[model samples]
Target: MTPEPTLAALLARLDRVEAHQAVADLMSSYINACDLAKDIDRIVEHFTPDAVWEGVGRNIEFGTWQGREAIAANFRGVQERQPFTYHYLTNQEIRVADDALSATGRWLCFEPSTIREGTLPVWIGLAYDNTFVRDGDQWFISHLAVDTLFATPYDKGWGVEMFTPVTAPKEPSHA
Candidate 1:
């Protein structure tokens, strides 16, 4: 017969499981808050005080913001630009550290958005790479890096032709 785990061993296993769940919950809450776009404070609370948020890829202007306040502002800016947005996340993978106090996760996101004055609704696919930190008993996002895979108008589906990166030609230098 297999020997039963000691109390300390069981507790360690529980801590790792809890850490994984916490990371998952944090990501879910982030997407929910963004979709609602009503409570910025609620979204800001998910991040650490010195957290960093970065967005890269072709659809939108790439930018990085540091600190909770800056991250909150970035989210607010997104809300302002996209009047309505529905975000979907899938294929999430979280890796908990041995200490059970930190973790890293990745998720795939599909976002359909309605712009304030735009005639066509836009759809975006992106990847999220996140780092989570546990402070006391609460887990917060330490870093969120988003890589936009594709952005297309709903009328025009995302196909082979849309695989190319969106780019703008550089302007002529006056000098």
Candidate 2:
């Protein structure tokens, strides 16, 4: 017969389970903030003070943002370009550290976005790799990196093209 785990072992297992769920909840909250276009302050609360947000692969054009202030600015820019979007996250996997002070996670995101008011509708496929830190009892994002798999027009599938040209928003004319 298999031996039962000690109380200490059971407690440790519970801790890990809680940590995993906390990390997942944090990601969901972050995504919700983005989708809702919440205040920059609220959005940045999900990250550590010195957190880094960057883009890789086809998303390299997004550059990188370091620290909470920069991250907030980046999101502001995103809000301007992507006025409306629905982000769906799936295939999420999170692993908590043995000490339960940190965790790493990955997720696949599928987004349908309307760019620049009603100018264009696009479909975006992306992958996210995130690192999280536990402070006191709250978890914060330490680092977030995103890679774009595809960003194509809604009428055209990825099979037709991987990315659609995204131009900068035009300035209002005063005549």
Candidate 3:
């Protein structure tokens, strides 16, 4: 007799691996876009219409943006001194849980901005406590918290936006 693989067994196997990499990839693009734009509207769409983005930004900036309007406004506020900026995400450590439906990850945040003279990059590695959602036919970050652990200023005088026709990064490689 041939062996039949049970459906429950397959799903259980699926739960063993992280399922939020796609979401992470999409989110990385969002972060990149925000840094690229002189304005924040372009990247604000990634968040939910009523999403709240709060963190210890300049002057201890932290608040809950009610919706698209509020979120965009808040980003614009922080982006005032951001014509020259870089948002780098790396060293990602992802964790899967809740039967392959939810997951979390750690991301190191780096920014190259002006401090005194020439531009220099500073490391502000932080923990990205995130929650994923299977939205429609794809995954999205339903909730994301960026907790800052370390930060320092640069001295190279961050350069103005210099991207020559930006293109989205390639999709997440599962290989």
Best by lDDT: 2
TM match of model 1 to true structure: 0.85
Preferred candidate (TM-score higher): 2 or 3: 2
State in Å the error of residue 97, model 3. Answer: 3.7
Better structure of 2 and 3 per lDDT: 2
Model 2 segments more than 4 A misplaced = 116-118, 167-175
Clashing pairs in 2: none
Ranking by lDDT: 2, 1, 3
Can you give the lDDT of residue 103 in candidate 1? 96
Give the per-residue lDDT of model 1 (tens digit) for 1-175: 9999999999999999999998999899988887875578988889898888877665554578788787777666666656677889999999999999999999998888765434447777889989999999999999888988877767777863344333321221111
State the local distance difference test value for candidate 1: 0.78
Q: Please, what are the lDDT tens digits per residue for candidate 2 over residues 106-132?
A: 999999997755488999888999999
Query: Could you tell me which 10 consecutive residues in candidate 2 have the lowest summed lDDT?
Result: 166-175
Q: Write the per-residue lDDT of candidate 3 for residues 87-106, one digit (tens) a residue.
A: 67878877667566656666
Q: How many residue pairs clash in each candidate?
A: 0, 0, 4
Residue-level lDDT for 143 in candidate 1? 89
